[model samples]
Target: MKESSLFRYAVVGLLFTMLAFSCDSEGVINPTPTPTPTPANERFLVVGDSGTILVSDDSGATFQAVTSGTTATLRGAAADADGHCVAVGAGGTVLYSADSGDTWHAGSCATTNTIDRVICYGSGKFVAVGEATGPDPYGIFRSTDGGQNWDRYAVTVTLRGIGARSDSQFVAVGNVSSLNDSALYLTYTTGASWTLYSAPSANFPAGAGWLYDAVGTSGGYFVAVGSDGSLYSADGGTWSAGGAVIGKLTAASWCASSSRLVAVGYGSGGGVSKGRIYYASSLGTTWTEVNPGTIKFLFDVADDGNGGLVAVGAAGEVLYSPPPADVHDAGSLWYDGVSGVANELYGVCHVP
Candidate 1:
């Protein structure tokens, strides 16, 4: 009876030891958790000159042109969380897509000036910036009703790029006609008022040059890129120089999945101009250029929402980098997707 009891005790102690070894620090048994699958219905919209709008349903493997209802050279596009997209362009064009780029309809814009850039800050709020024109010549337009209608705001600078950190906080970058230098404007009142910042300051000194595009990140960082490969960073308030690249950067985007900021533009080499792309892990401290292997000028790039990137540019060039888009690929991983039209593509957005 004593030997039997000793064997049972040894077995019980061994089982307890094994169970403890298998338990996590929180005293719960650890098991492999299944990862949530990414939705397969994600869409990519690329808009460009001649009112060309292209849609890709299969992760940018192929593209088909969709009628934008007007041939006004759409320049910029943004998509909200609810699948609503707004594209802005020349002649104050404001096109809205409720069905995620499948169909588009014109929205009433108060200004006749060309709207150069547009950003959708969820909940149906969108802000667009462009060249000065119309009776007021404000250059800033805001839409609160999913871009159905807009209201213009007055600012002295010709705003080319606009980015939003929130519905009430926004930053715009462009050039001052008189100064011939870059200009920065901030609006915290939902476009009700704006504060101007320009060259000749401690943060943005003189000779800063003109800025072309701006983008806001999920981490509350804003970056504006422009002439001579210049870059500027902000935290929704203060502004500072974000270093520069080797060429002119026309547009920038934040890839949340990879935590990288990608900027696209054109650079001159051997007296021939070709597209340029650069990636930075942080705001703009350091940059690494990626050769896209094409001579076309890349105007805009957007995160694929799955750790990849899609860039569109001159001659309807559409480039895609599949998942795990490591910057170290040295341009070998980029694939030139088929965009049907030959028109220049200026803006791109991913709608999930």
Candidate 2:
């Protein structure tokens, strides 16, 4: 071979040898790291009319339907930190999942009354509340064994929503026989006993409307929202009035990361019902509305476990807001999410 060609071949051979040594056994050089799979506990669970249950594992970007094992209208659901999820609905139906909502099984609530809301607290303790139904209906039910069994609690007033600040502290809000008057109940012994509190007439001077939902904050505060956009707050003792929104709020949730309370419901706009979202930063003392860009009636709202909020409502409407560093920002806007089913969605929860 010519001298020039001989030198070229030698250099090429040297380069190939160096490349071989640089690669691992898989023939990959400095391979990119594989992304960690999303944990099951980070999923969002949505329940609606006709036993509709939708789960989103991708931070509300997409969702898939899951069998709820019942055709009763599911009004509310909650998931514990341990991945246990329980859903409550019409006809006193209760469904549970031990796998973070991947699969569900029916559980006995011992009543046929419609369960409007469900909440899970420390150590698998679950509490549910709804309207009084049937001849022997109890408005509240407690389950300490991950919902395998339940104990009923009798209250004179119908309870619509329940919230817990700790395993021992809880508050339930609803109305008496008439929607014109509201009722508040408190339990400090893990629901062993409950006491009714006098209504704060100053907050609802005309008449206490139906209080639909209540949420407890990490800061030891409980806020409840209800008819005519009314809001009330309690500091573990005294109940006081908070600011009102423009429409009735069916559901409310506290976002610890942002220190904001978000509520969702429906309001009349241009003679048509439209979904409404409101946020309060001053511990529910005042609220400002944020446009969710939808006309469907929103029934429930919850943290998306990704520092954002997910709301579900009429006509299977699912709305999602991006994680706003400041949720109280007036410019914040919500976008639409696909829920697949057209059933009226009533409740949503995120298991972080």
Candidate 3:
């Protein structure tokens, strides 16, 4: 070969060798690191009229429907730490979801009465309460077989709400079917046997007091909310007033992360009342109200397991509060977004 050509080839070869050495043997160069995706922060199960059940993997930003296997109106839902959920509603309707509410199947309790609320606290153990239109109507129920079947309790009052501190202990509250009668309050210490509790006549006047929901707190306390106000119990039996006169509180939840309690309901204004929300750091203490600016008839509220909250109400309206702190400001949380269903959303629950 000519000297000039050979010199050029030698130079090209030297440049190629330098470039090859600069990179790894595998030929990868300055590769950008792939980012790890964030898993879903929270999962939520929401049930409403017409047997509607929706799941929101992204907090409450969006929702997808799950087959509920019934056309009855679903009123309340409950979940354990593992995300096993049970929902109840009209006509004694009971639905169970083993996979964090992703899918559901119908279950029977051999009653034609309406089940207003349900709570699952232990493995295959569930408690529900509601009213009935037929014989032996108003009372509570117990299910040891994971909602596959249930056994009705002896309490004859219209039980609106129920909660369990453990598998063996539970508290339920409600009102008499007759408006003139007193509220129906009771507690279960061990099993089938339930002891009745009478609220202070001064605090819960007859015909005016109606307890709707009760929840077990991580702090080892139970708080039952109602139209007259809130009641707190160290053990689920003896109760005292929580002194919250906000309005007709329908539901309350205990947020263990923040050690706070949140309650939701509607104001008792004359006609077409607006929704209301209250928060308390301690039971039997004064509760502060949260103003959402816009009015909605909120029926249920739950802790999001992220220090925030989720509430559902009329017209499938959902409200979500952010995590790690205060959301009292009108716009601090989000609302007014539609859930695609026109039916009223009666209950909401969050699964970690």
lDDT of 2 by residue, 124-201 (tens): 779898888558658888888777778988777888888877888888889876547778788889887888764545
Measured with C-alpha atoms, the lDDT of residue 48 in candidate 1 is 90
Per-candidate Cα RMSD to the true structure, in Å, reads: 11.9, 14.3, 16.4
Off by over 4 Å in 2: 1-41, 198-206, 235-237, 269-272, 325-331
The residue pairs found clashing in candidate 1 are 200-206
Candidate 3 residue 53 Cα shift, in angstroms, is 0.7
- Model 2 deviation from native, Cα RMSD in Å: 14.3
What tens-digit string does per-residue lDDT give for candidate 3 at 128-164? 8888454755467777776777787766577888766
Sliding window of 10 residues with minimal summed lDDT for model 2: 25-34
Quote each prediction's TM-score: 0.82, 0.83, 0.79
For residues 138-251, write the lDDT of model 1, one tens digit per residue: 688888888889888777778888876677788899998777688878887887688887766765755667889877765677777888555546554455667666668888
**What clash count does candidate 2 reach?**
0
